[model samples]
Target chain A: MAAEIKAPAYRQFSIAPAIQPGSMADTKTFVANEKIQEAIGFPPALVDDWHDRAIAKMGELLSKYRSFKVYMDACVHCGACSDKCHYFIGTADPKNMPVARQDLMRSVYRRYFTIPGKLFPKLVGARDLTREVLDEWYNYFHQCSECRRCSVFCPYGIDTAEITMAAREILNSIGYGQKYSNEIIGKVHKIGNNLGLPGPALTDTLEGLEEDVKEATGIDVRFPIDVKGAEVLLITPSADFFAEPHIDSLIGYAKVFHAAGISWTLSSKASEAGNFGMFIGNYQQLREIAMRVREAALDLGVKRVVVGECGHAWRVAYSFWNTLTGVGSGAADPYAMQLQKQLDHRYKQPMHICEVTWDLIERKVIRLDKEANDKHIITYHDSCNVARGSGMGDVFGGQFDIPRNIIRAAANNYVEMAEGTTREQTFCCGGGGGLLTDDLLDLRVKGALPRMEALHNVTETHGVNFMATICAICKAQFTKVLPYYGFDRRTVGGVHQLVSNAIRLGDK
Target chain B: MTMTTLFAALFYLAALLFSVGLIYRIRDYARTPAPLVIPTTPAPRTVGGVAMRMAREVFFFESLFKGNLWTWAFGWLFHVGLALVLLRHLRYFIDPVWDWVIFIQPFGIYAGLVMVAGLAGLWARRIFVDRVRFISTPSDHLMLALIIAIALSGLFMKFVSHTDVIAVKNFFIGLLHFNLQALPSDGILYAHLSMIATLMIIFPFSKLLHAPGLFFSPSRNQADNSRDKRHLSAWAAKLESGK
Candidate 1:
């Protein structure tokens, strides 16, 4: 909460944000406490022989994750991905460069794993795994948002996110946990959500939401929790219950579900969709968090599982949950088979809320009034994880189209940011990859520069008042950082917020 | 050892290191487990599509084309020209000059100049561009310089020095037949060969492994089927069994 904006306070707004190299080099996140690490099932404190253990973990990862291993050897330093990182573009720290950041770990990888680094380390840019190297790993690895924008332009598909994850995993293995992400993961394990909000509080919040909706609209709009035999169980980020703008999207989801006449309920046991386990790059922790949803769905007897608008959570739900739990295709796996058998085979295992909304709009299951949002010209900010990591609807690029279609149905005026900044080449909100905490405010502000500049363009040219995104982190980041750049903090809202305001409730 | 014997043994040693070391590195990459599907979308979903993507990346430097144009131009030139030159050199290894090699000889000669041009452009950026310069290490510059030197020396042997082509062919053929023969003694020819030998020795151990690493990269090569198919690594599978 003590986080404040640090900058050339106000950057000269431009269509394309200027690259200020090394602007965020010294930024560091708060270190994790023993309790937070212990809660997430890691070593509670830094070990005496952390260096040895760290190297051993890297060795283990090298064998376990092929992306980490191949990428370690793949970089030719052709400098293709050097300028692709939004952090590097915003902060200008040479280390923020994707290639340079990977070298932080690659150098050490060369030293121990490859033959030449053991012999002539300098000749190949390889270095030993010294204490200084580990410190560099922590600082620069956390600086990366894991946005995967760099991988879009990387000739060899060397995802710095994969490397960043591998580095953080290595750091965590040595008991050097990042406070923000580790603490959030701990809260998630203890209370079933990141904010540590209790079940009774969640119940109260849903009740309040129901009352608020009824007050706003003359009709009774229901927001239910733990209703057995519900066809769909909606798992949203807990921030939807606790935070602003995020709560508005929660309202939107309820409206869409209400109009579509789906029997849906929220589960206190699986109230969270955002998984911080991914931020630390721990598979065990990631699996543990995913299991909550699987268990909740089976217990509640929900045939269809729908994930709410949360970025990396969507990626985890859309991509990893199938294998991590038994949500999707992984039900074919013997362990996953039990849960898979319970899930309705008629629907997509975990449908994205956008996909569900888009489907209803397509089939005329829900009619929407575009005029309700006439006062607002909206532009969609693609959340990096959802844009790059997950797909929507049925096709390959339904991820990009479905949300935009839903927006077009909900609003008359829509404009795209610059071609490169949209779709697969989209920039990070600068607050992703677990750097959304207050300790990294310096970076969070700077990182948002590229994205804010893009948003600034839409406002200037298209009279766009709202920048809608699906991720809670992006909403929180833009809402927080927009004020520093002389824009209203209310400029950022969720994609569903647009849908909520425009849905025609009176019609069949 | 005599000069012919020494050079013959060196080439053999370099070839052995290059092939065996490259195989070991490639094998390591192939064996590593990719636990999740992480293709950078919109990625090809099928095997043929992946091959097409790889082809575009190799032939056109598709991703680099999306990045900086200057980097792409120079990078593409060096790689494509290097391919031509390598193919052109196949004339020396084959018994009778292959018709394709003979046909490409003129273009291959031009490709040597293009290779030098590409290396010069790449090396200049290393010194001039702030971001590129910052990320580049000492070896990065040296790599460009080493390739430039090889290109320049090879060009000299082609146009300026005129090394004994027949003798070069005989020497390689003899070497291929396990019979040592006199190598062309031109200093430029020796310089080109020595640099090439050095490059071969470093291929697997250096960042040059990007050549083989491209094929194994999970992000590029993976199908975006994580939602539709369950991808579990060997270690991850073990975790489930343990659970």
Candidate 2:
């Protein structure tokens, strides 16, 4: 079965992270290779003066970003966010606390930037920029998913994600990078997808999806790729083309497009939506990755753009795409002006597939046979990047409701997990912010503890045999972590996967 | 210098340090670019809506309320009480005290009590709460100690040993108008004045800058109109346009 990944269990986490001390400090991920670093225009390897270069980069970032400078200074160490992080709650590592994690950079920032720290570093607990501090930054910063859960609770609105991103960016500048995110970014640039799936491979994958849907429902649902003059360019995660349940979501998107009668095609040049550049906080690389979508849209002459099920990709698309490349209208700048003129202005630019699907369901354009999903008791896991960083529909909290509305519409049985753990205050799947690699397996499994505990409540009470989400990373991470917690790996899938099983598609 | 001249010179030095330091610090914060729209979501989409959000955060500690309640209560008490007490201090600087400042003076004493109590509760949390204690540094405790000492000394000068109000008022008014006068050198008053001077001198350099820094926090202040409007920082624009 596709659920079996053929890897040994790193550790079984039946119990959640006990609120003890120092539970997760020793864990680490693989380091990026020279080629991966060079591909993204960073240093090929660590130089002899890496410390000075890192300090210089930190200085550059403090001047260039207001949030970084303000957050570094604004923290009063009040500890409001000490227990807000799911990783901290699950693992109980003291450093996992958001205030402590930000202090890693703040201490250095003070030593270099503030007069008191410059004169009496020890009095303020400020440390000189040294090799040991760099090691600590790599260890703890990667443990953070950049989920921004801590930011929601912080009085000064100090976002540890911003600090973590800056630290990662400096780490990369000095030739220290995570193997997973850097490699994926390089792959996205080189082969148009994170998996390095070639144009011909993508075509074959789409063809296979078309055949699978055709055989299952005996309908001619098309999964077209690189079709010219299409109305919508569907930018989705590359994992959707290969992974088990993610592939199921791809099939679901094809079915929805067929039913809605919208002309859509996946672009060969910009097949991936998950941008790893945002993971490392490198603005140049982030912009370069996002511009691919615009390049694909402009090259293919598409009128509208829609994103598929992916978490951080949606954040980048919803929050940063416009500034990076005028993907949306109303921006007066040349970058936004040029792209806005080309995109058909009648539709919302870069709509979420869930929003589009929800809209169609609302108008009764797509009918769902709820009985088809009766066997599965379903609950939704809010993707962190989507829940905290982006919004959906026209309303403010529409991001939370639209996905549940779609789930409720498509499935017969739906139950929300705890109220505190759902909606805007959701927990990450432990594998977000580009820590979704085999190297960070220990952290990912342990990070999945708090979420699993929340899921346990719904699973036992509601008999929720299935956990549905809209992000590809959440789907993949849960599939990996579920088995570690005695749940079947097959229990996790996408919201669209449920939609695929329930949608009655012949004459919509 | 004589004791009177020394006190006068110190006041002038503190005024210069506070004003110049605050201006430059605020200038740096304003100049730093916010390159992304990262308001924690379900955030407001309009500028006016953003103002309301910040008002709630500053006045009520909205996010902290959602976090730990005890921390919120203490934090709120400290901040609100500090606000009232600071407002009540305007009576000394103005020749004819404003009616509002006079009305607040009664509550100002109570505010001083509340502020000390809140600071005590917070300090206890730092010493007793494991999560808080783990995050608290020596400087964190010292920052609290400095503020609490200020509040207690001010209370002592008010209720325990009184200073000559006329002389104190003349000294502040003279300092305000650049007309030198001998400041009251009462033991309690000296302790209180030096602490106040220390706070003002370190106002821009210390974590106390959070007083103004909160206003410019992009996460709290930025609108959730990322889809409707594009926000390209100068550095980002230069990079994007060239590419």
Off by over 4 Å in 2: A1-22
Off-target runs (Cα >4 Å) in candidate 1 are: A1-4, A7-25
Model 1 per-residue lDDT at A422: 89
* Every model's TM-score: 0.97, 0.97
Q: Residue A178 of model 1: what lDDT? A: 94
What value does DockQ give for candidate 1?
A: 0.69
Native contacts conserved, per model: 0.76, 0.78
- Model 1 chain B: lowest-lDDT 10 consecutive positions: B1-10
Clashing pairs in 1: A21-A92, A22-A92, A22-A93, A23-A91
What would the per-residue lDDT of candidate 1 be over residues B134-223, giving only the tens digit for each residue? Answer: 778787888888898898888887778798989988898998999877887777777888898899998888889888988898877877
TM-score of chain B of each: 0.97, 0.96
Candidate number with greatest lDDT: 2
Where does candidate 2 clash, by residue pair? Answer: A17-A90
- Indicate the fraction of true inter-chain contacts that candidate 1 also forms: 0.76
Tens digits of per-residue lDDT, candidate 2, B81-168, equal: 9999999888889978888888888999999999999999999999988888887878889888989999999998889888898898
